[model samples]
Target: MRIAYLILCHGQPAQIRRLVMALPPSSPIFIHVDARTSAAVHAEIHQLAYLRAHIHFVPRHRCFWSGYGIVKATNQLIISALASGEAFDRATLLSGADYPIKSQEHINAFFENAGDAEFIEAFPLHAPNRWSNHEGLYHGASRVDWFHVRFRSRAWRSPWRRRLPLGYEPWGGGQWWTLTRPALELIADVARKHPALPRFFRNVFLPDESYFQTLLGNSRFRGAIAGDDLRLVIWDRPEPPYPAILKARDIECLAESDKLFARKFDLYRNPEIYELIDARFLRRS
Candidate 1:
């Protein structure tokens, strides 16, 4: 199984290097660095990537927090991975801070047995159990009915409540996912044939969580979706910066989880967690 990895990162050159090195080198890596990344930081990333020709970077997109740019960069990464002349059974999306929790062999075997299933965290917009942070959005009329977070300074609402383009049922969840080739192609095809869907998502609040998700959930592939997202992410802390910056103390929990990858490791605050994860899970037996 030739798995492809799509990574979207803005900073943390060192952490990115470690993540790239840890993955199976036989697989292709398609990365999209933020266009606004400092030249110095980009150079640092480039230097580390020079030796690994299989690790490719797409043209940078100027990303903004909770902005449409996140969706654009993610789209670029997916398109790049598909364009790469490789027939991949799985294409896993990851953040720059994410690290593999399982060994390369374990990950491969899991995907090998995964027959045509799409692993995305998805739920209907009307689901009563929708994520709480989305606040009343689960009850919104549709994706286009919601106002952009930046709609205030010169805010404007549509003349009439707009329905989701192409008749897609609103479905979304955490941005991370691992998709099979069929699911990926369907997403790309929808975007290509029906340009209206992408247009509808452009300025919507956090389109990254909805765009591809809504596309797949409404398709014939819906039944095949696992709804797991295949990632171990946490946000239980009381304070902000959710997806809590994992620490050395959290090792046992993370290691025990069946998730293939874990996210949001803060290299600055506690590098020890990285070493701990590496020694216990990343190192070869």
Candidate 2:
């Protein structure tokens, strides 16, 4: 089974190169380095990927954390990957900060067995026009219930209190996902069929998390979603900036998590973790 990887990242070209090298060699990788990245780093990212076959770089977007730009960048990658004419069995959306924690063979086998089951997390985001059993625990209720606007030198929130456009029961989830071709196609189709969809999400805070989730949750593919992204990301850490950077101390967790990949690692802070995973998980037969 073929897996197409769509990666979105702003920095850490070296580590991203490592991520590319670790994936199944024949799997197509479509990457988007944020447009706001330094010229040097951008050049370095392209140069580092120069020799990699089936690794395509798409148009970049100036991505901001918790902004709609991230979703745009991800969509660019997805569009490029799909346009490649490859019949990918699965498309795993990742960041350059992510690395596979499983062997390439195991990774391929997992997707082969996974079939059309989408690995994404989508919870019914409690909104004014929606009612959900997932209310008390949902933290992004405001994402859909309130309007958020971000522009150059301007950031504002609240106002325009409206229900989810087009009768969608708003759904929210982690941005990362591994989905089937049909799921991604459905999302693309929905966006094209309803131009207002993207515009609605463009004003929502962190559209990357809600946009796709809501689309799939409201589509025919809803029953097929597995409700898990399958990446071992640590969120409840006692620190700022999370999906806490994976350190050497997290290596044991990575190994034991039985996950296909893990995210947000920094070679600068914990180079040994990369070495350790390369030596054991990555390089292992």
Candidate 3:
């Protein structure tokens, strides 16, 4: 079965090229480079002849951290891959700077074991039951607002909701995910059937976290999920909104997670992380 790598980035070309070279040539790559980024970024993508055919430049738009754009960009990627008609077996969505922490051999083996199941690790995030106390939040907070207050809930928003074949679950975690073709199709179908759904979800807090999780959890294929979004990221001092940059000290822990990937490595301070990954995890030539 084929595996496709999808990365969304607003970074330098040399860095992205280095990442492209790190993966197998046969594995398809799709990138959504924010158009508003500098020209050098686009040029770098062109330099990587390997990704030229698979590269997809999404329409340039300002992505709100808690808005619909993130999901829209992802949906665009899914549509592009399906339209490519390549019949891939699995798909992994990654960020521009995120790197894989597992060897290709291990990654392939994991997917082999998880056939037909969607690998979108998630945790329970109850709503109103937990959010009702917040001063600004309303009794009927839209799913979008959970992005900011999910961790503070006092009780399950509703456990029975999670029991349905298509139940609701809290959606907050790393944006990366590995989806089988069937799961991808399921997501696409939902997007198609409900024209207003994407817009409806765009306003939700942390929609990226919930949009996929809630949709899949409420689908007939919910049972097929692997239940963990696998990636290691350390938050910066004071716990900034973005994750901390990876470093040498974090390498050993990341290597041991046995998860498929780790993310947010510092391009400068963590070149060694890349080297360590190349030498240990992926064994890139």
185-268, model 2: which lDDT tens digit per residue?
A: 887777779988888888777788889999998889889989889989888897668779888888889988978889878877
Candidate 1: C-alpha lDDT: 0.80
Query: Evaluated with lDDT, which candidate comes out highest?
Result: 2
Write one digit per residue (lDDT tens) for candidate 3, span 1-285.
568887777766777777777665568777777655678767677567655455545454445555566778888788777777666798889887878777777777887887577788644445434334544333223344332323322211322111212334444444679888778887898889876666556445556766787777667767877776677767645545568777777778886686777777666756777887788778775
Local error of candidate 3 at residue 107 (angstroms): 1.0
Local distance difference test values of all predictions, in order? 0.80, 0.82, 0.67
Q: Cα lDDT for residue 8, model 3?
A: 74
Worst 10 residues of 1 by lDDT: 151-160
Q: Write one digit per residue (lDDT tens) for candidate 1, span 1-285.
A: 989999988888888888888888788898898988999998888775685758888988888766678888988888888888866788999999898888888899999898888888887765654554444433333444665545322323344455687677778777999998878888888888998888888756567887777898899998987889888777787646787888898899987899989987878787888888878887843
Tell me how far the alpha carbon of residue 216 in candidate 1 is from the true structure, in angstroms, after superposition.
0.2
Model 2 residue 185 lDDT?
80
User: Of the pair 1 and 3, which is ahead by TM-score?
Assistant: 1
Q: By descending TM-score, how would the candidates be arranged?
A: 2, 1, 3
Stretches of candidate 3 off by over 4 Å are: 50-60, 127-173, 236-241
Show where candidate 1 strays beyond 4 Å. 132-144, 149-160
Q: Which stretches of candidate 2 lie over 4 Å from their true place?
A: 127-138, 151-155
With a 3 Å backbone cut-off (N, CA, C), the pairs that clash in candidate 1 are none
